[model samples]
Target chain A: MIDIQLSERQEKIIDIVKANQPITSEEIAKRLSFTRATIRPDLAILTMSGILDARPKVGYFYSGREAMSFFTNQINSMKVSDIKSLPIVVDEQTTLYDAIVTLFLEDVGSIYVTSEGFLTGVVSRKDFLKNSIGGVDLNKIPVGVIMTRMPNIVTITPEDSIIDAAVKIMEHQVDSLPVIEETVINNKHGYKVIGKISKTNIVRVFVDLCKNN
Target chain B: MIDIQLSERQEKIIDIVKANQPITSEEIAKRLSFTRATIRPDLAILTMSGILDARPKVGYFYSGREAMSFFTNQINSMKVSDIKSLPIVVDEQTTLYDAIVTLFLEDVGSIYVTSEGFLTGVVSRKDFLKNSIGGVDLNKIPVGVIMTRMPNIVTITPEDSIIDAAVKIMEHQVDSLPVIEETVINNKHGYKVIGKISKTNIVRVFVDLCKNN
Candidate 1:
């Protein structure tokens, strides 16, 4: 739900903390030219909402770490499938050069490489460097050789929590996770590439959650 | 060059094509459900703006393959300074449990592990899984054993472009890049532990850019 309750003054204060956090309360009051007393309640409410972060003897600042807290607390918590990007996929036969072109063209950082409709491997930009940098003939080489083959692929289901995906990203350190429905590419629609969850998407959600919670 | 000359409808049409690109003119017509006559001028203007994309017989889409193109344009053009995140550093003596807490608290996918103020190993969730999980001792172990050690580390400079980082991510198949200001960790607050750029940050940029562009 949108926060329609915070006063304009409070909103500005929240924005200020977000813009330059890890700042002192006294410093914030001095720079904004507001009295410490006047800023207290705003800070208090914002902190309670998970927007402002306060540590004893450390003063106050905006919390970038607040997202997970809010997610664990609020959000009415929806299924990851309720809101995920449909993944973009490519075939093993796709040339390295074309895969790079496709990655940029589709505005994605990774591509799922398949063979005969089975999840064979995934070709991401991370794998492209050793293979694509020099004038290696991208047209002649198939994406198969450079992919992280399946049975070892990291994936998530639609029913999982968003934080679950976020954890996978940090743990696995991959940019995106293909939200699979049994088989990601072999789904009924050929659009089996349904729902992608990227770290940036999580961050945006983090920002929003921080502001409101 | 900014695309400011196109009319609102033309821009809208271009956005629509981009949203579900690799689509045919007929399919684009179906999604927006626009008439052939209504979409003609918009397509023409987008083509004039160098925003048009087409397959030999596959109909139309948006083009962002160049510097001004959607996916690669901004990241490709971004200087390393713009997108790097604030860094969180941990001394080599820190325990694995502490690193886990810091990792979760900071919301970053990885943590830079330094020894005597120089670039050393990097500890990520993957490392934790390999070393920490399935073990009887969870809190006592050090992260150094599981980290990607210094000389083996791949990094980018604070001066590089986001595209360069993207290429690294794709090429090296790593989750995040540490923005190095030199292997030195300075005493001055201004220079130490400068920034980090994660794959998640890139996803956020693309989502917003896709919407507005």
Candidate 2:
């Protein structure tokens, strides 16, 4: 799914540099039996795109760790369905204290609130901190009392791009987003939670790409 | 610099969708006077890459904003030098109380601590919170005593990829990183702080890309 267009000659150039870096364009052209003038545009394209680096006296070298650029391509082409993780869901009736425990036990930054399997709201560490610092009884207060409700909660669909999901996560300043699907529940408009996207997911993607590459 | 490669035909398809969305693959093929079979692959590439989406019976529609995908490409190819913000610095001798005041007054999540213009340590919101919650005297404590010191603080060089910066931010779980250049100061090994990279920079890049696109 990589959308970056690298011609055969250009890719071969990258391969050569990876094998023996700090090689000059003249040396590269000689290796390929092509004139430097013929291969100059390829070098320019690669360098301009940050795929290669050229130092005045040091010559051209393969950019270290090109995996991130690869991952970026993957993320743009990828759908939320490709990388979303299962959400930690709780009932709205769950106490704030219980939700806090769940968050810690699950090692999650946020929890989805549900009623009859319909996404109702979301509670996060920030929310818990806000509520707890106010001296409200965590055990007596239900999660529904302080949770960010639907329509206000930023969400993503399975079909959405992972890049879109990343932007949503940042723009909303939420650690996680519930991947939702619209459904008719008792003839009322509602959304069913299907997956979750978080900053950790993006980090994991980058790590995996780096490792694999 | 956007590194993602969109074919001329794919670019044309995107332009067509931008002008008249909810366009079908068949219609696009007709507009180009090409067979559906000839155009099907192009449509698939565009949709799979998230520039366009198809609904059950609704044909194809432009995804609300493809700017983030474009920005992701831009960020991946971009060097840290291309987008880093100026560093907010404080001296090591600065008091904890003054540090806290500066943190809020500057509206920054973290500040770099310097010794004669060489980066020595970093103070973040979490660091301030941890130090403050201990009920210690903020007026008496120096930031150097509580700040995260170098060699332990994650840093990025200007030539590194922005993706590398993003990875460092996530891996260290720090809100920001001091952009540094290795230097010698009075016969001591140190780094000259030139810039800073933060989650906000990435978000700002995305926002700017969207606005411009």
lDDT of 2 by residue, B119-210 (tens): 98998765665455355788899999998897798999999987788778777777788899989878888799999988767555543544
lDDT per residue (tens digit) for residues A42-154 in model 1: 66556645667798877678776432221233433755776687677788888877787787678666788766665567776546643543346767888987789776777
Fnat of the models, one by one? Answer: 0.03, 0.07
Model 1, which residues run further than 4 Å from truth?
A1-213, B1-74, B183-192
lDDT of each: 0.64, 0.77
Deviating ranges (above 4 Å) for candidate 2 = A1-76, A90-108, A124-145, A170-174, A183-189, A203-213, B1-77, B86-148, B170-175, B182-189, B199-213
List of clashing residue pairs for candidate 2: none
User: Relative to the unseen true structure, what is the C-alpha lDDT of residue B211 in candidate 1, on a scale of 0 to 100?
Assistant: 34
Top DockQ prediction, candidate number? 2
> By DockQ thresholds, what CAPRI class is model 2?
incorrect
User: Considering summed lDDT, which 10 consecutive residues are worst modelled in model 1 chain B?
Assistant: B65-74
DockQ of each: 0.03, 0.05
Model 1, CA-based lDDT: 0.64
TM-score, candidate number 2: 0.51
